[model samples]
Target chain A: MSVSITVGAYGVAFGAAAVANGFTVVQACLLSLLTFSGASQFAVVGVIGAGGSAISAIATASLLGVRNALYGVIMAPHLKVKGLKRVVAAQITIDESTGVALGQEPRGIDAMRKGFWYTGIGVFVFWNLFTLAGALGAQAMGDVRAFGLDSAVPAAFLGLIWPRLTGNFERALAVGCALFAIAMTPILPAGLPIIATAFIAIAVGLKR
Target chain B: MTVQIMTTLWIATLGTSLIAFLLKYSGHSVPERWLSHPKVQRINALIPIALLSALVAVQSFSEKSQLVIDQRVVGLSVAIVALLLKAPFPIVVLSAAISSAAVYNWL
Candidate 1:
């Protein structure tokens, strides 16, 4: 319950940030409703907010969403759903749900299933609610930049990625990627520099 | 002109959502071994880190086609401090916003 709420409540930041980037409240809500993945949704708004092209936004968001595909692979057999239910299951096969389900592995498959459903549904409900609240709140604020909400974009990204920098190698690679992106900012278009960093990762992976 | 921009944004928004859903659904439908290749998994694991780190940099320091060092830097610095202190997500983000706003107002 705590995990779901905590993760879901971050939707407030997303909603506000989306509006700060010029998305209408409905658009912001729709992103959360349809995309549902935090990082991918953020990439969409962030890229477009920076005046990137639609292709760039879609490319960046799809890249961030690759992990969900992996998560679905992990959960499919265990979930055992089909047809419409399979679609629903795919929608909610996110980081929190997958982690919670896996954490319950010691208890048995039944417990794991329950954990997955409860966390997924729990997060979904709270996320949409908080997103609505946040969009409305940000809309009321008028000048979001005056509140330094622009700064919130990078800060939010930092918060999301912080947990994943678990090892020295990962941390170093992140710093390198950040520097590389900064260096390429002047040369590349709005969103291309960030996408370019994927090559660095692929190179490292292949080398290893 | 405004309609054109709005139309573009709407297309991007819906298109991104569709791609995201399809990616997730494909995982369940596709054979596991296709994705479970050791090289594939290894590269996939590193992709988010690279992309997100670059995103943080790009968002924080770039404007249009130029690199910048501005109040957002001050804000991001404070955010790093808050994270180092093990602050909660909201607090980390809020502190960054507040401090950056303060800088923007006073300076």
Candidate 2:
């Protein structure tokens, strides 16, 4: 429950950031409901907020979303469902659900399935609800920048990536990617720099 | 002009949603061996780190086509400190915003 709520509550930042980026409250909610991936959802608003072309926005958001596909691969065996249930499982197969499910592996497959469902559904509910609350709150604030909500965008990004920097290699690669993107920012269009970072990862991955 | 921009945003929004769903579903449908290769897995794992770190840099320091260092840097620093101290997500984000806002207002 704590994990679900913690992850879900961050949707507030996404919601506020989306609105600050010019999306309507309904659009913010729709992104949460339909997209349901925090990082990708943030990428969408961030790219569009920066006046990026729609194709750039879509590309950036879709790239960030690739991990969910991998997660679905990991969880598919444990979640042997069909038809509508399979669709639901795919939709909720995210970092939290996969993490919680795998963490429950020591107990048994039953426990793992329960962990996945509870956490996935739990996060989905809380995330959407808080997204609404955040959108309404930011909409009422009139000027989100004055409140320094603009800072929340990068800070949220930092917070999301911080946990993943588990070792020296990951940390160094992250710094390199950040510097590269910053260097390219002045030369490239709004969303392309972030997209370009993928090549760095690809190059490093292939070299190893 | 407004309608055109809105149309673009809607297209991006729907396009992203469709892709996200397909990516997730495709994982379950595709053979595990296709994505389970070590090189593929390693690159896949690193992609989010690369994209997110770049996002942090671009969002914190850049504005449009220009690189501008402003209060957001202060905010990001505070956020880093808060994360190091193991602050919760909300605290990290709030403290960063508060510090940045204070700097913007007072300094």
Candidate 3:
């Protein structure tokens, strides 16, 4: 359950990345507090790191975040709480917390409530903690790519998606989309694949 | 810019929460017609696969992706190998991370 918070800890790393990329410490810290999704944060920072415009980077990260669309759908019933609380529930519903919440049974509500709250608070705390840590020692972190920690993001995604592989069709689709994205990575914008993934998922769903 | 940033943050929050809530809530109704068929289950399951593949491509592969490969390729390969060897997923991830670093430094 706390694994969800691990996603948050990546916040500190992201803060460091953001500062290294030229955002003020306040900007880095606030991004984590406000934005919570590590992949999108990384994607945003990666774009800036690569010298892309800030607006473009923000758009890319936000686009990449579209997967949360499906996560939202997957989580709605589990959390079961509604109205304004629905709004708060939505904030912490990232891949980790959603997975923990959705993986359970009718206890999903209990799980969602606890998991979401716990993970959300945990991430919030850790994200800021690490962000501050990272910000304080930005230079030492070096090239995140060189440390290979950047790879954890996709590895995490694989962990998030691995359970969905149930057949040849699914296997083929996952491999195909991954390969396709990889091939066009040089040309496609950062967030495009996220949209492609959702569409592809829908297409595969309909095909089935 | 603060207003814009805050607004972007709000929109992103509300927009994503609503979407995720929908995805989570949709599970409430498994759709009896679909549940009745194995074919449909097989198909329904594929959507996640497609989504995952799209993610791997976005995160791992690129237009700059080379047929010759590089650290990420090596890292992913190492992780896949670890997974096949039954390393826990986190371990697999860590191994991949380390290998990518090794590959990066190697070059």
Candidate 4:
């Protein structure tokens, strides 16, 4: 609950930034409700806010979201969720739920599934609730740009992704991808450069 | 929002949602042996780092279709330093937003 709430509260920044970027409060809230992934949600607004086309925003967000699929694969056998429950399980298959599930490995599969459900539902509830709060707050602000809330999107993204850089290789890989994306920004279409960074990952992965 | 903007937003959100759902479903369906392949594992691990770095770059350095270095760069840099110092997530975001507003106002 603590982890989910604390992490979910950052949706407020996203809410404010989404509105600043021209997303209606309803659209912003819907993104949180449906998309449900922090990095991907931010990527959508980040790309769209910066004037990238919807196609580009979707492409960028989808690329970041590939991980959730991998999470599903890891949890599928353990979860054994079937029928309509499978759909629900898929919806909550994010980093926290998967992490909590995996972290309970020693306690056996039932405990792991329980951890996943608790964290997943906990985050979903809090994340959506707080997203509405943030959107409403940003809407009330009226011209969030005057407050320089536009910058919050990028900064919030930085905060979300920073802890993931746990090793020298990861840090170097991130910097290299960042440079490549920046260099390509002037030449490529708005969202293509970020998508292009997938090649960097493939190259790094192949080398590994 | 105009019809165009509304259409675009719906399309993007729904498209993204569909893609995410498909990926998750495939996870349930794909064979465990195929998933356990070393190459697949490596790509999965590295992809997030690459994508996020790219996002940070484009978000901070680009505005619309043009490349424009601005106060967002300053905000990201401060956020990075704070993150390295092990500041909490909310604080990192708060500090970065503050620094960004401050720099923009200063200019």
Model 3, span A155-184: residue lDDT tens: 645655565666676677778877765565
The C-alpha RMSD in Å for every predicted model, in order, reads 1.2, 1.2, 6.4, 1.8
DockQ of 2: 0.79
lDDT of 2 by residue, B27-85 (tens): 88899998788898899878889988988888888888899999989999999999999
By summed lDDT, which 10 consecutive residues of candidate 2 chain B come out lowest?
B4-13
- Give the per-prediction TM-score of chain B: 0.93, 0.93, 0.66, 0.90
Ranking by DockQ: 1, 2, 4, 3
Q: Find the 10 residues in a row with the least total lDDT in model 1 chain A.
A: A1-10
**Candidate 4's fnat?**
0.66
Docking class for model 2 is medium
Q: What value does the TM-score of chain B take for model 4?
A: 0.90
Q: Per-residue lDDT for A39-84 in model 4, tens only?
A: 8888888777666788888887887787887788899999888999
Off by over 4 Å in 4: none
Model 4 Cα shift for residue A152 (angstroms) = 1.8
Best by DockQ: 1
Give the Cα error of residue A104 in candidate 1, in Å. 0.7
Instruction: Return whichever of 1 and 4 wins on DockQ.
Output: 1
* Stronger candidate by DockQ (3 vs 4): 4
Model 3 chain A worst lDDT window (10 residues): A45-54
